[model samples]
Target: MGAFDMLSIAGSSMGMHQTWLDSLANNIANVNTVVSTSQTAFQTQTPIVRALAGGGVEVAGLALSDPNGRLVSDPGNPMADADGYVRAPEDDLATQMTSLVMAQRGFQASVQVTKDAQDTYRSALEIGRR
Candidate 1:
């Protein structure tokens, strides 16, 4: 691939990683949400990440978690259902933390790639002028 293509790919990778981070943030924010039934549970969301063989990257879609929300029985809870059962999201905090770390790494790598490309171009210009 050309240098421009490398830059574009790296740029797109950074964007994708940003989207992933956003998704993870949203999931973490709603970790305590309560739903009445399986159909209405607050599902953890994950980004559909795909790699481009040639250049760049694209987000295909977002996937919803389905491991089943925890059925907590609390009659006094505001979101409690008629049977006193609340569907709390089944989010694993440790898993989410790991994902956040991975996303951060991906973003950092993309940024470094773009920066290197810029430095290479600048060096070439200096050589041409000399």
Candidate 2:
């Protein structure tokens, strides 16, 4: 592929990673969300990424986790059920943190690729000038 194509691929990857990071952040933010047992709990969102045939990445959609939240007993809470149990989001903080780190690394790598491509293009132009 050409330099422009490489840049496009890297740019797409960066955008995809950004989306992933945003979703992870949302999941983390709602990790402690609680709801009545009769209602659905906050579901963790995951970005669906797909490889394009033209050498770029695309965000297909988001996948939501099952509504199987953890049941916690808290009799004092106002939102607790008849059994003094509330449903908490099943989001795992550790897993979300790890995913965030991975997404950050991927974004950084894509930025580096974009920078390298720009540098290569600049060098080629300088050679032509000479």
Count of steric clashes across candidates, in order: 0, 0
Residue-wise lDDT of candidate 2 within 69-98, one digit each (tens)? 888898888999888999888868898999
Candidates' C-alpha lDDT: 0.85, 0.92
What TM-score against the true fold does each predicted structure earn? 0.85, 0.94
Question: Residue 30 deviation, candidate 1, in Å?
Answer: 0.3
TM-score of 1: 0.85
Residue lDDT tens for model 1, 15-50: 999999999998878877776654467888888978
